[model samples]
Target: MPNVSKCQSLYSALVSRFQSENPSLVLSDTISSWLYQSIYSIYETSGEEEAERYVREAHMV
Candidate 1:
C-alpha cells in the first residue's frame, strides 16, 4: 500500500485536475476536510488486504 504522503500527492493531483476543468469551483478548507475523511475511511476500513487486492487489480488493468 502507498504511504500517506503518496496518497496525499495523488489526492492533490486529482484536485488539480478537477479545478482545472471547473474553474468556477474553488477547493476550500471544507472540501479538503471532506476529502481527507474519505481517504482515511478507505484505508481504515479496508486495511492491508484490500489495498493489496486493489494493487493486483490495477496491475491486471
Candidate 2:
C-alpha cells in the first residue's frame, strides 16, 4: 500500500467500486462499450487527453 500514492489508491478504489457495484457489467461487449463511453466521459470531465501518471501506474496492480 505504501508504494501506492494516495491519489493512485483513490483512483483504484473508484474503479473497483464500479466493478463491485456491477459485476455483470464488467465483461464482454457490454464492458467494451462502457469503457469506450468512459474514455470520452473521463476526458470530457477532466479535459485530459491521457490518463494521469498515477492512474496508469496503479492500473498495473
The candidate scoring highest on lDDT is 1
Estimate the overall C-alpha local distance difference test score of candidate 1: 0.56
Instruction: Kindly report which residue stretches of model 2 are placed more than 4 angstroms away from their true locations once superposed.
Output: 1-27, 49-61
Report the lDDT tens digits of candidate 1 across residue range 10-58: 4565566566667776767997777655555565677644543433333
Summing lDDT over every window of 10 consecutive residues in candidate 2, give the lowest-scoring window: 1-10
For residues 1-61, what per-residue lDDT tens digits would candidate 2 score against the true structure?
1222433444555467566666664456775455445544554556342434323433312
User: How many steric overlaps are in each model, in order?
Assistant: 0, 0
Shift of residue 13 alpha carbon in model 2, Å: 20
Which pairs clash inside model 2?
A: none
Best by TM-score: 1
Per-residue lDDT for 10 in model 1?
A: 47
